[model samples]
Target: MTGSGTRRLGLSRVGAALARGWRAVSWYVKELVGENDYERYVTHLRRHHPETRPMSRREFERAKLDRMDTDPQARCC
Candidate 1:
């Protein structure tokens, strides 16, 4: 209702919007860099192959690299 109160409310709203935008950008960057791939793979294994043991980070990265080496489609132009 007061001038200072209104200014504070506007600032809070702007802060919240900035925070959400920052989070979106962060997620995009993570995906772009393959940072979330391991987490996704682990989730998939848990969902579809619960009996199988999930690969460790090193093993998973090695396996991914091997597959890319063997698969031509994985190579960039």
Candidate 2:
């Protein structure tokens, strides 16, 4: 292969690796911050409680905060 061709291939590999790394970091951050909790809750409802309706994001967050307020020990800090 030509020198420029090999360089292009190496650059492409680096770009792909960087993309995968970014996705991993994004997913980790979202999970750590409970950003995906509503999505997970919806999935759980569809699978295990098909008869129940899932809460809207606003309602879910409000309820979650209310629970935490009632049980201060559940707070991390």
Best by TM-score: 2
Instruction: Report the backbone clash tally of model 2.
Output: 0
lDDT of each: 0.94, 0.94
lDDT of 1 at 4: 98
Q: Model 2, 1-77: lDDT tens per residue? A: 79999999999999999999999999999998889988999999999999998999999999989989999998887
Give the distance in Å from residue 12's predicted Cα in candidate 2 to where it truly belongs. 1.0
Q: Which ten residues in a row have the lowest lDDT in candidate 1?
A: 68-77
Residue-level lDDT of model 1, residues 1-77, one tens digit each, is: 79999999999999999999999999999998788999999999999999999999999999988988899798574
- lDDT accuracy of residue 18 in candidate 2: 100
**Candidate 1 error regions (>4 Å):** none
| lDDT for residue 75 in candidate 2, whole number 0-100 | 80
In model 1, the clashing pairs are none
